[model samples]
Target chain A: MARVVVDVMLKPEILDPQGQAVQRALPRLGFEGIADVRQGKRFELEVEGPVDDAALARIHEMAETFLANTVIEDFEVKVETSEGPK
Target chain B: MTARPSPTATLNGGPTGRWNVRIGVVTFPGTLDDRDTQRAVRIAGAEAVPLWHRDKDLKQVDAVVLPGGFSYGDYLRAGAISRFSPLMETIIDQAKAGMPVLGICNGFQVLTESHLLPGAMLRNNHLHFICRDQKLRVESTSTAWTADYTAGQEISIPLKNIDGRYVADERTLDLLEAEGRVAFRYLDGNPNGSLRDIAGITNEAGNVVGLMPHPEHAVEPLVGTGRTDGLGFFTSILKKLVNA
Candidate 1:
């Protein structure tokens, strides 16, 4: 069995208004020196038994096609088992 | 070309007689605008067919309208999950085969998610849900929708959505422009920070269009902001069906 996580984030070139609103408010709360902030989503999936190379590839495909809108977002999959999130 | 007649002019009778077209309005669980869309279709002199998101068949409607609303609670991004609904599978195939499909607001997000249209929608540049009577210029009259208005004619409709800013790669934007796929664009002011001031666009075949505004809300003088700028979209589809 393997547990994996996928992080989906808007591409750097894309504008993130939510992150910007938060970034602007931080200064009012006495927090400074923060250059920027970006918002994203993280999805954790549990796979039952026998993780293999093909399984990893399939997970990557699922992240690209379903878990993320690749046109404007990028996704990274991390295998939390043998690999410490490569 | 001049714009169509006044809204009251069509109030006398939906059409001079019965129209042969049936327009389908899909209702996803969270859809808030299905009734409005059906009303618009009826006002346009067509039979308004009610379609369920869970239903796989399209009911042989001449056209389909995916109305605005928070489908699937706008979870995992607006329109993402709804794009995979059972009905959407049929819609995707039918839309690709040149069936007329108009997606408004959240519906627009679904069209993009399903790859029936290019580009994606992001949060409004101000990171808020913006609701307003937005002014838009008709950039193309060749699509399944928008044929009732002349190119460059400006109209106002209710624009409401949280994730409504349109984004696409430069190449795609340029291609859309070159191909005249930009069916509608913001006029007066760019309300949502959309690229190129685009408010709506069409597929390559022009049978599918996706926009961030609710044209359904503007089809009548008695409801919504009392402006009738959106009647053209509904009427335009009927015109196409008649001509086909």
Candidate 2:
């Protein structure tokens, strides 16, 4: 089986409230030197067959259309091969 | 397809018999304001038809309204998922064909997702869910929704949202400004740090409008804030559809 992972994050220009909330809480929790923080989301897709270059392209299209809103956010996809002998 | 109300039919708050003009209010799974939208439509003296996110048909509504709410639990960005719903597909097609459409708050987010309008919504710069009566100036009266308000007329309506900041590229913003497509602009103060105090916008065709405020909440004068400023939106569209 192949696993495709998609990561979505707000554009650098857009404000991220949840990440800011975390950054604010961390200071109270005694963490320091955090210049800034931005939150993001990740999705894992398990494909039934091997993920080839075409599969990666399809996953990218899916991410663009559904998994992430390109208007305010950007997305990246990575494919992983199973760790097994053929 | 001009939708006309029956002759000699009086529109009352009760039965509203003999009226044929129907306005559709869409309900997504997590939508929180469908009932308020329906009430506002009925109060505006039209039939309010409930449209489901999963359905493909608009039930032959003369106009469609996407009301405020946290649709799809605000997952993957607000309105991202709901925009792909079956009903929204129909709405997008119809809106492009000049069917009148209004999107309020999260519905505005959905409209942006569907590409019916430009720009995008982001979290409030203050990172808070702001709910308050807001003042806005009607900037364009040429659209189907704002005909009742004269240009520069100021009105107060409820503004509520966590993700209410509207952003777009400079070119798109300039085009919107140049074309006079800006329907409403925030007054008194910019509530959510939106670009140029833009509160709402209409499409190039002037048939679709999306904004970050809840006009449905302002229809009843007794609804706490005592503002009936939003009734103009409903009435304006009713007149437009009837005249079409």
Candidate 3:
């Protein structure tokens, strides 16, 4: 089995209020010099068979169609690993 | 929420019986305002039919209302998951074919997700859930849901939500303004930081309208802040369907 991952984030031009709130609290938590922060969602998928280019393409389509609202978000799909777990 | 009279009997003595005009109110799993929307429809002298999200049929209703609520628990995005529901497929097809559809609050988010309307809703700039009575100006009376309201008329309706800000590209905004597709604009100090104070908008054909405010809550004069300003939406569509 193989694992695929999709990371979704709001477009750079869109406002992310939740991320901003977290950023505002970082200083109080002793974090410093963080230029910016943006909150996003991550989806992990388990493939039943070998992770091939065709599977990647299908996952990309899923990201575009259901995982992300392209109007305000951008998503990237990556193959976490090509081999099954030990 | 207040204790309100049952909607089983309408004040108009059931004109729906004579006109045969039935309006559908769709309910998703997590929907909360479907009943109020049905009551609004009944008060407008039309039959209110309940439509389930999992069902593909629209029950032969002349028009449909997607009421406010956090469908699918607003997971992933406000309306992303619900837009893929079986009922939305039919809505999208019918809406494209010139059927009248109204989306309120979270319903507006679904319309955007379905691509039936442009732009997506974002979290309020202040990062807080706001609930209040909001004033909005009727900008375009040409839409099926706004014909009973004269242009430039300011009305107060209940607005509530966390994701209520509307955003779109500058070109699309300009095009909407140019074509008079901007159906409503926030009047008194933008409530949720919507772009250009846009409270509501209509599709190119004016059959689909989506807004952040809860017009269904303000339809009855005795309930919901005791204002009937929102009844114009239902009445407007009733006239349009009857006349058409």
Error of 3 at B30 (Å): 0.5
Residue B210 miss distance in model 2 (angstroms): 0.6
Candidate with the greatest TM-score versus the true structure: 3
DockQ, model 2, C-alpha based: 0.57
lDDT of 2 by residue, B66-121 (tens): 99899989987799889999999888888877788999999999999888999998
Please report how far candidate 1 places residue B213 from its true position, in Å: 1.1
Q: What lDDT tens digits, residue by residue, belong to model 3 across residues B56-140?
A: 8887778889999999999988999999999999889888887889999999999999999999899999988999999999999
TM-scores of the candidates are 0.92, 0.91, 0.93
Worst 10 residues of 1 chain A by lDDT: A77-86
Ranking by lDDT: 3, 1, 2
Better of 1 and 2 by DockQ: 1
Positional deviation of B159 in candidate 1, in angstroms?
A: 0.9
Q: What is the DockQ of candidate 1?
A: 0.82
lDDT of 1: 0.88
| Residues A1-86 of candidate 1: C-alpha lDDT, one tens digit per residue | 57888999999999998899889999899999888999999998888766678888999998988899999999999878655446
